[model samples]
Target: MFKKTMTTIGAGVALAAAGVLASGTAAFAHECFNPNRSEQGNAGASHSQAWLTVHIDELTAGLPEDDAECVLDAYAATGAPTSFTIMVKGAVGQDGTIASNNPHPEKAGDGSGIDEIFAAHGADIVGSFEECGVPMPF
Candidate 1:
């Protein structure tokens, strides 16, 4: 009886561990798309409207470190308040909408919202990054 109970408990623990591992992998998997990439259509026009989107929670998953830096740098470029905003407040659903807390009006998968925000505001946010003593990845 003791042996059987131990075996059952061990099996349950192993199954639970497997479940956790699978969920962890899924959590890291993110889908990134730029509908206006240079290869897609009009160069300038497409690039201008571009934004980067993922599960709002996984903004940097698929993107290269440099690309992520560039996105932040561009956000630094945007002035804000006077211009548009770029933020990741919530995940984009299959129906393609965001949470009410998300202030940006644009939909996901359009372009790098950071880029758009920078293009519109043209402010410098890198100062804060610099203050933090973190080197820019881009």
Candidate 2:
């Protein structure tokens, strides 16, 4: 019947789509590639390794609020600033100060391009993957 044929085709399409999505997710899951990764440092992985705990408040504070991609990319490239960001999470200030109240202004806006700002001035910032407490995805 036409209904049976259509059902088979729909299932096939769904399976194909799922396969594509799974492959893409796997590829991006481990995208961290640090070219300057050092083996000489004594920095060891934290036992906690909690998500979103990497405190980049101070390091990322200088990043322009509009460009999160650029900031993330630069961090991915150097892995230093990220290392120094923080092992904990919470409200962080532009000056890298942590507070119990008041979320960052840039984080509140839609056009906050933090990464683009960092990427534009990545040469000026300082930090390293050795400083980051956990492994990073480049």
**Which one wins on lDDT?**
1
**Number of clashing residue pairs, candidate 1:** 13
Local distance difference test, each candidate:
0.32, 0.30
lDDT of 2 by residue, 1-138 (tens): 996565345434333332343234121111111223233221332222211112233333334554444545555675444432112222235232122232442431122222121222223233332343322222
lDDT of 1 by residue, 44-80 (tens): 3223323222111122234576655655555445432
Residue ranges of candidate 2 with Cα displaced over 4 Å: 1-54, 57-66, 85-138
CA shift of 76, model 2, Å: 1.5
Candidate 1 ranges beyond 4 A from true positions: 1-51, 54-115, 121-124
